[model samples]
Target chain A: MKWYQKHRETIVQTACLLFIVLFAYAGLTKLLEGHLFYDSIRNSPILGGKAMASLASWALPLSELAVALLLIWKKTRLIGLYGAAVLMLLFTGYTLAIVFFAPYRPCSCGGVISLLSWEQHLVLNAILLLLALMAIWSSLKNKGIPWKKTPQGR
Target chain B: MKNLKLILAMLAFIFAIGLSFAFMGDTGSGAWINYNGVPTELELDPCQGNGNDCKVVFEDDPNQTEYTVYTDDTLSQTRKSNNPEPYIIP
Candidate 1:
């Protein structure tokens, strides 16, 4: 128990590790189904049209890769956490649109995870976002940084 | 704390930019069709499937060319045409 308490940071690190792994898997899957993802994005009201959708199709995968890389590096872990959280939020919004508005079901996020329904995908994103937020909060709090610190520290 | 907040804000901005670009590039739907004498190829809508089979019928001449391709499967149907004008399966 004492040993576990002493290595509590490891638990936080593990949470981050899990998030990175999940995103990396999802990111790679998206990259593989790049064309289908591009089609969905192009059809989305938020994503406007084909030309811009193509650009986004290219960027999203790279961004996911960047987030994974950042999380693995001690110097960039916080940045990665923030990036992952924001990406999840965007994905949540996109999933909501499909659940509420879109008439057709998009391709299953392929690769190792297989196919998932829109609602299931949304839930997954939400859970990941929550985990990421918790990890980021704990990391900052443990670093002796008070949540409500004054502009000029006490 | 300040740095954390700043990083979070920056991430939010990046996401917004990404989502904006995605929205700007949206294309509703599209398809392609290639009818060459024997086997016809079609780019179908993802949802238009019957169990494991995919159905494609010509919009202009439905009776002339009717096809059903299995999922992840191809269809090969021959049509007699001496001077063939590439048929477009709407």
Candidate 2:
């Protein structure tokens, strides 16, 4: 079997697993630090007005959780991957926008995500987004192909 | 494709989640509304009577006047100012 054929399944599975864990952690952080997250949203420049900011604070985490849950199931993994890509893009774009244009930066994103500098955060998000795309594309191509069995399971 | 609807629904569900999150915090933690209704914290003591510490605006009252508040200066005359307003502590 060709190298691409041999490793395609492994790559897709890893991507799915990565997204599942990433979204779950992201969601749990928001749930655990709900108050801090809300304050952060209220301080956000993107979600103008109190109402939208307030909603985003909690919505972010739950959305992450929803994405993770969807990715976990074989039947819904594609949908989950698509959602993950959208969320990642939105997050990355927000980070880039605030860093470059906003008068004041809001540190609402708590946990390890917050620890990264804006530039670093953007890069990390971009990487994840790319991974989601690769996973989705590979899965789509592998739809009708028989699984290539390797003697040593990766 | 039917799967397309599912993807769209997933995104829509998040917006609903955002609404729920917005309503979750009854009293916004670590923040208070300022004159503009922006979420901010009082970094300085409001009761200290430092004229620079706070700006109190009674929008509904007729005074419609702006003042640099100075009061509670009993201990230190250097920071105290006598204002005609009776309610303002000196």
Candidate 3:
């Protein structure tokens, strides 16, 4: 077997699990200490003291959990990867914006990653996004076709 | 999806944690007080009327063991409440 086909399942599985941990921890922290997350967002130059603060608060954790759930299923796994990449892209963009523009940026990130500086956070998000993209490409290569064309098997 | 229950479990977990924080309210007890839900300390001059009149008051302080270690796991630094509101030193 070729290198990718030999290790395709492992690679995809590892990617999914990594994202599961990432999303779960980040989402759980926001939920556990929601007030801080909410306040931090509210203090942002983009979102601060706005009516949308409450919406972002609920939507963020909920979306993270949703993407994580999608990743757990084989049929929906690709969709989950896409979801994760999109979320990470948004987060990376937000971090970059804050680093460049915001005069008083607040760290709203949860989990141990909160210990990282904003620049480090951007790099971390970028790494995750690249991993997710690699997973998507490898999965497509393993199947020999797009995911939708594959037979549904248990 | 083979594992539908796992999704439900995660949702339940999220709800449980969120509800716990919500029910606990914004502030915490002990030596520090939560300012607008954010833990903060009053850096006042405990002798002058300009701002500080009282020192760090604790529930049980016979030895005056100043508690400096805070329960701050947040990304932002500890917020300090000044006397004049937005104390800008030029």
Candidate 4:
């Protein structure tokens, strides 16, 4: 058997774990530094309006945590993968817009990730997006695992 | 074993959370400043000394725009000298 096919389940599980770690860390930090996160959104060129920034500040961290929770269980893993891909796409799009069109780019990411410049953020988001897509594809191909519980609930 | 991998993942998650807490700080905290009539975003660290000592670092190029920020108790009272050293973005 091919190496990837032989280890497909392990690979997919690892990808899920990575997503969980990333989202949980991101969500926690954003919540911890709520004022700074809100300020970043307020100063954002795309969503600079007060109301929009206010709404996004709360929505973003909650959504990230929700995605991480979804990825924790076998039944919700696919949905979580899709959620992660969508979030990554939005992040990548925002970074691309800022790099190409914004008046200036600011490092809004908290913690160690804030060290990455906008260009680096674009590359990292793109790579993560690809990883999410690949994991979803691999997961779909491996359909031997049962989705429903047996009568005995084993 | 599957359980061992799960345990390792949980441990990594815990480590990540701890690291996040350790490194968390005000990264993008700043106010918009009118530098020589140009609206510039500068990261102004809290001034511990008399307000004149606040080093205002330019968001894009810190070295080029390194200048002292003088502000009264409020940000609205902040002022910069006319024709201050022009910052060249590299």
lDDT of 2 by residue, A34-90 (tens): 655654555455654467756886788889988988876678887888899899889
TM-score of the A chain in candidate 1: the value is 0.81
- What is model 3's native contact fraction? 0.02
Q: Quick one: best TM-score, which candidate?
A: 4
* Candidate 4 B-chain TM-score: 0.33
RMSD of model 2 against the true structure: 12.6
RMSD of every prediction: 11.3, 12.6, 11.4, 10.3
Interface RMSD (one decimal) of model 4: 8.5
Candidate 4 C-alpha lDDT tens digits along B1-90: 867755655665676688679886644434344566555554422222121334444335635565444343234554432222222111
Question: Which portions of model 3 show Cα errors greater than 4 Å?
Answer: A146-154, B1-90
Ranking by lDDT: 4, 3, 2, 1
**Candidate closer to the true structure by DockQ (higher is better), 1 or 2:** 1
- What is candidate 3's CA lDDT for residue A143? 72
DockQ of 2: 0.05
lDDT of each: 0.58, 0.59, 0.61, 0.70
lDDT of 3 by residue, A1-154 (tens): 5877788878887787778767766676677667657656655665565456688788998898788778777788888889998999888888888778765445444446656888888888889989988888877776776745657799
Going through the candidates in order, their DockQ values are 0.06, 0.05, 0.07, 0.20
Number of backbone collisions per candidate:
10, 0, 2, 0
Residue pairs with clashing backbones, model 1: A42-B27, A46-B23, A47-B22, A47-B23, A47-B26, A48-B23, A48-B26, A49-B25, A49-B26, A53-B25
**Worst-scoring 10-residue span by lDDT in model 4 chain A:** A145-154
Lowest summed lDDT across 10 adjacent residues in model 3 chain A is found at A103-112
Highest-scoring model, lDDT: 4
